[model samples]
Target chain A: MREMIITNNPLVVEKYSERVLFIDGSVEQVLIKVRDMVHRKHGLISHPLPASLRVLFSPYRSVIIGRNNGDINPLQVEIVENSILKYKKHMDVREVDKENNEDYQMIDLTLLESALKDEQVNSMLSGY
Target chain B: MKLEIGRIHIKDIQFGDSTFVEDGVLTVDKAGLIASLKEDERIKDVQVDIARPGEKVRIIPVKDVIEPRVKVEGTGAGFPGVTSKTTQCGQGRTHVLYGAAVVTVGDIVGFQEGVIDMWGEGAKWTPFSKTYNVTVDIQVVEGLEVHTHEETVRLAGLRAAEFIGQAGKEVEPDEVLTYELGGMFEETAKYPNLPKVLYVEMMITQGLLHDTYIYGVNAQTILPSVMHPNEELDNAVISGNCVAACDKITTYQHQNNSVILDLYAQHGKELNFTGVIMVPEHTTLSGKLRVADYTVKLAKMLGADGVIVSEEGYGNPDSDLLMICKKLEDAKIKTVLITDECAGRDGLSQPLADTAAEAVAVVSTGNVSHVVTLPPAEKVIGNPESIAVLAGGWKGAVLEDGTMMCELNAVIGATSEIGYHNVTCRLY
Candidate 1:
């Protein structure tokens, strides 16, 4: 799990399990992890991610999630790589109105990892 | 499996002493056909007529359009399970009246029935206008349940098509086309470098007014599964839906699915066309989730590198399309979606009820809400007043001078999601 994520939101890191960690650096090193899992054996098994999680990852140019300090979860790397491959064309995020109380925020990569884990547990519970 | 399609190109249709095809002309015994339809106790009356291309004829409240086909050498004769005994189709020889169709018109079942004009501005929108249509105007027994009325009309159309297709049995086809696909491993070995593409076809399977049938079973009761693409070509899939006319895939479109034909043209040369996945568009959220999840799982299992998904009815089914796209993209399979738009009259509203960033490659058929004006035909086939209450039409749709104004939604096959027609949209 060799990756670095840039985000100031601590809630993002809080969502992940204790085994996951966010290092304060760049995730350029995780590119190797993605290349390694590109040839993994294909399987019929699939775990459905939450709709909210899909929306969370919809607009990112890239996403990276690693394990404690610099080790990447091979499965997570594959997920992020697939997301980037499906990208058609990116558009600028809509600007929020000054009068509105809400605004867009950078997606937390750790939450995506946590959602994947939640899906796995749910799939197992349902005997998938 | 391999099947040879023998197309008897019918140039025109006329009522005559007996039913037969002579020199490309289809002469039908109108009284005899109508009498056969009356055999069903639920059907009170049946009026048969013909509408040819370039005729000033209008067929309103159209229910379904069926292409007449009969298997001459295959295990099945007509639409298996529905019109014939349960047997496999898509094998052996079948004869079709290529340029003809059986169009059913009746009282409105849902607000989704459509209008077909033979010659007018409206004729340009519907594919049925070009076909030599044998109109079956049916009247169900009074107080019949809504579902019974729909089923009665649906079966009658199939019966008429089956009856008419008999004339083509003894005639020679002007042209013949054969379609065959080998086993998975065989195809893979033949086209090792090409992408393995599959078609995930979603049919509207919700209860009344939104149903598609496979082998005479309502798709609503079936789970997501695989289907031989040729089976669909051999009248395996039947449109029982009464959705907004412009986008619904009629039985004729299903039999001559353009996407399947286009993909077959590219088969072996560009890609190894895998097969079809029949998925039902369920009404419940849980059912949607389950079906979508299963669909992608099957695609991945089949080693699909690319998949094309087509939707039937709109609204809730859009969610199923997006969900399937999300799952397929997540599995690293490229997906292309074909659908129609409900973008408002002004075209400012969101095109689909649901959207996903994963559905980046989409082919929009057309906007169903775009209003168009059609000068009334000199002869109206069905009830014209039914337009006021139809889905895409309002009370004043029929104007003072016998002209009618309505949305594209009321025209049959105007926005076929199966890529049967050429109508599309562009952002302003």
Candidate 2:
């Protein structure tokens, strides 16, 4: 299955290279791209929202989305759409805390690395 | 499984020539503890500090808080797999240093570390503020990666708890509580007319700093597994995640899980407590579907008529919680969810990211995004500047005059989904 990482974190772009869809803006910008692509049948491989609410205020984000040739998955579209709204609602509390954005960027990359870890193990198990 | 828990009430903690408990006061050899904890090559320095209730003390960037306990009649002692030999727990006589806690403090490893204030306004928000705290300030080797740094501090807290747990081994508990539940079939036969209830605990099992350990195994690597309630009581699980401190299940909360204790309080009288299903909140959608399906399957296997599901973190986990709730209710298993709402600061935002018509009975454990103002502390442990990077804290969070302002998101145990903290909403 072909997948791509849509991220604003430079660390992810530097590590993943070819599979990266680097976004040069904030986390919401990355999710905007994701919602647009999922509308075109690019299904989400990872959940759109960050695991915790605190990181929802982070400036960086990385989402793994699988490129699908079939019709849009309603569940995927709903998740993406709901997540964008959720992030915005949370942003009502305050803007992204970018003062320590380097930490946020690293944390975002770690979450991306976490999603890629299972893929690496699966690939090794398949002996590819 | 049946286990007896003995509690030795500790009134205060103070440094002394040696570590021991006398007349409810826990005397610790600060130098000795620092020496033992400093044995780890990853740790450069360790400090032993005491923060009692009503003191003007603040501990920030806290990693994990653990209760000191010793197993006198069990096979697995000292957290079993993580800090000791891999052995089954929950079937033994465990003694708890009831009011005392070992709090690990260090440099900021992630954006989710939290604060515990021991006096005045801050004390009311966090449950840890009331405990007689023995703070372990650990300074790890410089330039260590964040992942290793988290583990290094996590292990230190466990080790310190184990060391202090030894004090309880020789002392008599003020009271002993017994938790005994027979096999599923035996319990069903015993209470044929009662409804079977299951508790499904969801742990954030994403990558890096988000993880939970069961008997030393990473929970994310395994399918949703059914565990005996006693296993949880005996230290079978521990938190290794940095999921926002407000709702993160600290190791102390796991040792004395409020959900498990409340269910046990009604184990036989009302509902036949079936068991627990430790569910992992994965970051992938497929993983969510698979685990939710498996959780429902387990609840059905237990013949659960009702189940209480509690979430660990928020946002992405709202989907996981409702997915599991939807699956269980679809199976005709009445479901109730326990979660903290991120209703934003004004409490106007929708409580959860995802919802299900089946989730009609959700219990809100306060709102994580509720902003709070705390007065300045006379003594601050760890770096106060750490508040700037906290999930609930902004750059100017540490105001002049030593005052602090943050969301319940950064306050430890403020909005615990497990009903462990003091935050509650009373209709006026």
- State each model's CA lDDT, in order: 0.73, 0.86
Residue B28 of model 1 has an lDDT of 91
Candidate 1 lDDT, tens digit per residue, B1-428? 99899999999999987889999999998988988899999999998989999999989889899999777886878899998888999899999999999999887332334889899798889889899999999999999876788899999999999999999888889999999999889999999999999999988775556678999998877889798889999998998876557777889999999989988999999999999999987644446778989998899899999999998866557678888999999999999999887666677666775667898999888877677888867887888666554422234666788677777777888888898864755679
All candidates' chain B TM-scores are 0.96, 0.97
Which is the leading candidate under DockQ? 2
Runs in model 2 with CA error above 4 Å?
A: A119-128, B108-112, B390-400
lDDT of 2 by residue, B1-428 (tens): 88999999999888888889999989888888888888899999888788999999889888889999999996888898889999888887999999999998886544555889898887999999889999998888999988888889989999999888898889989999999999999998998999999999999888777889999888979899999999988888988876588999998899889999999999778999999999998888877888999999988877899999999998788999999999999999999999999887788878899878899999999988787888877898888667666533445766787666778888899999999999877988
Per-prediction DockQ: 0.02, 0.63
Worst 10 residues of 1 chain A by lDDT: A88-97
Q: Where does model 1 exceed 4 Å of error?
A: A1-128, B108-112, B390-398, B422-428
Global lDDT for candidate 1?
0.73
TM-score for each model:
0.76, 0.96
> Highest lDDT among the candidates is held by which one?
2
DockQ-based class of model 1: incorrect
What's candidate 2's DockQ score? 0.63
